[model samples]
Target: MFWGDLHVHTAYSLDAYGFGTLRTPAEAYRFAKGDAVGSPAGDVQLDRPLDFMAVTDHAEWLDLMYTCTDPRMSAHPYCVKLRNQSTQETGGTVFRDFVNPTITQAQPAKADVCTDDPSACDDALLSQWERMQQQTNAANDPCTFTALNGFEWSATPNYSHTHRNIIFAGDNVTPTPVDYIRFPEIDQLYSQLEAGCRAEDGCDAITIAHNMNMGDGKSFDVETESERTLALRTRYERLVEITQEKGTSECLPDYTHRESLGECGYETYITSHSRQKPLADFEEEEWERMRSSYARGLLRRGLLTYANRQDAEGNPLQVGFIGSTDSHTGLGGYVEEDQWQGTVFGIGNFERNMSRMGFNPGGLVAVWAEQNTREGIFSALKNRETYATSGPRIALRFDAAKVGEVPACKAGGALAPIAGGTPMGSTLPEASKAAVFRIAVTGDKAPLEKIEIIKGTLKGESYEESVIPVWQSDKGEANACVIWSDTEFEPAAPTYWYARVTEVPTPRWSSYICQEAGRCEEFPDADVKIQEHAWASPIWHLPTR
Candidate 1:
């Protein structure tokens, strides 16, 4: 298996650049390859080199700030504003008054910037796209390190985060990125990508949604959409980011109570944001809406939607899970708590350090592939043969089959016969005997806590769920495996099973910050210690009629 981080930003992004990032795409790739890079906090480097990485800068104003900063382009009015207001106070105002309005509303800048010609704007964007592709090509090595070309489509409608990172399989990418400035709606972005990349020969792309916790319940909305819309979504968007620098979107604290699970909350940044104050104090309907903004909730919803709508190939829609660092400082795969760096560029002083404290070191993506090349890694992602981790390099595998047959080791494998079952991310076949699920885990940084097999089954219009603790380490073993059989299995019901591996408690990122300032008592409920964990993609068992 090869470990990688697919979502990251460099100085090309206007927000990262305006905040303080000075690293380029080349610098980001170098940092991912284990080279030390300069940060505002200090020198930053990954503890280990990643097999692959992608620098997905925001597509809204790709390289616009860098272009405007050039002396030759100072004739433009926007360039003049960027040159005049370089301070943090004035920069924030500039972002609110000028940048935010232009991108969010899809409004063009003053005619002076474009000089009354629309193609001039397109030319500037195309130039930046070419430059980005060139840098990515220069850093890509076939077997040593893979650098995939990608960009982020920043579609934050009404201040709600509905963002996606677009990753291409190879160096062959679209000539221009489809940003929200042109495609205001998420479906429109998918349509443009289908025309530009997916339909073209030898070019393919996938969109991974991230930061759903901040979406205010609109991130996973599929209630009243048509069959065609669902088909299009399932075709391009196959994975959702389960964890990131923003927060873990796996499950919510309140929703876990409804599901009869233990405390599953950790590093929740959504509730801490000022914009989410209304959501944090939700009354009735709004509180219920919170359930739709998490990974587990979306999986349940996807099962319902797939049962109703079939794709073009006549297969049910399934979504896999992955994690990324979402680092804005051009440091990919830098997850060490002690050697942490700030996400925003200009926030490093004592007072500004509080802004950085809320963010964790971030997560990593693990793909079961044969080689470290782009083809091998991209295939693993497209097939849903992947897992996620909250910084630790924990190895996990889940498989299911008949009681007497040998279980397959890979995820997303289809069931062959009634006697042999499927793997995770796949549908199970009809069987007479009970299905046996095998789970194996190997921990590196900490000892094992407990392994849970969470099962969600749908009956009629409602759903029933349970978290079965199948295995626990009595001796705190680093490696363990369990084979669990559902003796009360109902072959007529539709069910999904996924595994969650937890580690022994360790100091969280906030704990380190408080220890340095000698103010551990100030933040009493700040969750100083946490148990790092990993979640594998789910395997489904549909009713065989």
Candidate 2:
């Protein structure tokens, strides 16, 4: 299996640049290639090189950032104001100019800079887009490192995050990004992608939704989606980001019945840009927000929606899970807790030094690929053969099959799906009443304590969710393999199951930084312990039609 980070930003992203990020796409790709890069503290390098990555800079202000940095046009008065005191030391005046337009507007348009010369905006955007492609292609090495490129369509209307990364399969890509300003809605984005990326044109792409925990109960807005849009969502979006610097999108403790020990409430972060109140502040809408803002809830909702209706498509929200650093400074796959730095250079640095500790070293995406080439990695991603980890190189494999139909795990020493059985992110046998699931894992730098089988089985209109312990050990086992049977499984119910493997409790990224700063007591909320874990894509058993 190959490990990579698919969501990282360079200075080209407007907010990242406003936060005084200096690393560019080239530097980000080289950093993933195992080169040391300059940072605020000093030179920083990854402990290990990544097999693949995508530089997903925000598409909103590429033209403006490019205009401000260009030697020719940068002398303009508007560009001058944008560059003045843009770093964290000064103020967020210009930053506010760029960000407010995004979250405040129902359909965010170009900033004040766009009004000056709209054509120039297009020219600069194309220039920066080509620059990203060239720089990424320059660093791509087949069978060693795959440098995929993409742009983040940052939609933050009403302080809610509906962000999606538009990553290309190969060098052939759209001439320009379909951003929020021109094409604001998800339907518009999908239509443009389908129109742009045609098989005959040597183009292919996929969109991965991130920060659904920040989606404010509307990320996978199934309540109002049409059948066509749901189909489009299934076609365009295959994977969702399970964890990142901001926090984990797996579940919230109160939102999920399976999570009771507060383990579900891990690493929740609210960015400084949001004006919305905390999750606890909203009384009536809080439960709805919790339900829609999590992966487990969204998956269950998708299953139930399909189970009840024939008008909608077949489980349109059936998707895989992956993790990425979401690093704004080009530090792709730099997820080590001990060597942690902030994702956004200025804010993370300022917050860490002050011991505020909201952000964290994010997670990683591991792929089961045939080779290290772009084709292999992209194929694995398209097939949903991936797992996500919270900053560890933990290895995990999950597969489900009927009583005696499961194949051996010795297929090249790894598990593979066979007839009457399915791997993670797939549907099980059509008529099987129950199945046996295999959970295999190996920890890194820590030992496994528990392996949880989180399940949601349809019980009437809603689902009965539970987090059952499949295996446990107190002696800190480094490896685990368990075969668990779903004896209560019903063939008629719409059900989904996934594995959550947790290591023994360890110091969080904040704990390490706060302890070193000697302000652990002063920053009591920041200093805490957490169980770093991995989430496998779910195996589904939808109601038989």
Candidate 3:
């Protein structure tokens, strides 16, 4: 398996530039290639070179920053104002007043810069996009380091985080990125992608939804838009980012009946950019936020949707899980806690301090692929053969099949008795007697704590889940493996199973911050430590016909 980070931002993104990252796409690719790069905090480099990386800067302001700074654009008055405001030391003033409003209100800036004849601005945007593609082409080294041409569709409607990173398969990409300004709704974005990329012969793209935790209740809404059918959604959106700098989108303790599961609350930050109320303080209406925003809840919804009606087009509502750094400082796969850098740069020490306290080192996406090239990695992602890790380079595999069939299982591969059985991101075949699930995990930095098989089934109209401890280690073993059979498996109800492997307790980013600030004893809340973990994509068992 090869590890890579699919979502990262560079200075071309207005917010990233305002926050202090001055690195271009070339510089970001250079940094991911194991070269030293300078950030606002200091010079930084990845501990190791990533197999693949994508510089997915925000599409909203794809070339706005460069347009403002270019002296040749002095004829545009608003460009001068933007350039001047960006240099202000007020810390995110430009973003707060100008950019954030555009996203939150779904109102594009109609200033003279591009309001009347948008062609000039569109030309500049195309130029920037070409530059980014050129950088990617220059940086890509087949079988060594892969540079993916991608961009973030910043669709923060009403300040609700409905963001997605659009990654293309190869160099044959759209001339320009599809931004949320022109395509505000997620469905519209998908339609644009299909029309632009999928319609092409060799070009294709996949949209991975991220930061669903801050989506109010709209991120995983089962209600289809006028244009977005279930088939279209399943066809385009193949993966969901379960963990990132914002927090883990896996599950919340308060949201589920399985509150006893100790690991459900790892690095949860739903209250960060939202109403700022803690999960314990959530009101009755507020509780619905977690239900729609979490990955587990979304998976349950997927099962319920699939059970109600099988996709006529054969595109089921299964979405795999992956983790990304979501690092705005142009750092990809830089998730080491001790070597952490703030996400934004121009912010004062106060914001930087808060970043260190609240933010994590970020997460990584692992792909079971044949090589390190773009084709190899993109194919693995397309097939949903992927796993997510909370910083550590943990290795994990989950598979299930009948007792007699060969154990030809891999994450996201399907196995059905009628068809064989199902792997992660697939619907399982009907079982006669029982089904055997095999799970294996190997830790990187810390020893293994335990391995759990999390099963979620739709009970009536609601969802019921259980975290079954398949394997445990008392002595902190470096590896844990298990093969268990569900003899009491019910073929009447649809079910899904995924493995969660946890490492021994280690100091969190918050703990390191507190210790360095000399307040480890005083601030108990800041001294939080956690067991880093990885989550395998789920394998599903459809109801036996």
Q: Pick the candidate with the highest TM-score.
A: 2
- Superior candidate under TM-score, 1 versus 2: 2
User: Which whole-number lDDT from 0 to 100 does residue 258 have in model 2?
Assistant: 28
Given candidate 2, what's the lDDT at residue 257? 39
* Candidate 2 segments whose C-alpha is farther than 4 A from its true place: 71-73, 106-116, 254-261, 270-279, 345-356, 406-420
On residues 410-489, what C-alpha lDDT tens digit does candidate 2 reach at each position?
31244444445677878887777677888878778989899999998887776788999998988878888777889898
Give Cα distance to truth, residue 535, candidate 2, Å.
0.3
lDDT of 1 by residue, 303-413 (tens): 676555433322323667788999878888988665664456334443445545666778888887778888998887877777888889888777676657765432223
Candidate 1 global TM-score: 0.90
Candidate 3: TM-score?
0.90
Instruction: TM-score each candidate.
Output: 0.90, 0.93, 0.90
Clashes of 1: 0
Candidate number of the best lDDT: 2
What lDDT is reached at residue 81 by model 3?
62
Candidate 3 residue pairs in backbone clash:
19-345, 19-346, 412-424, 415-420, 415-421, 415-422, 416-420, 416-421, 417-420
**What lDDT tens digits, residue by residue, belong to model 3 across residues 6-93?**
9898878777666546678888888888999765556788888788899998888765765765324444777656656664254367
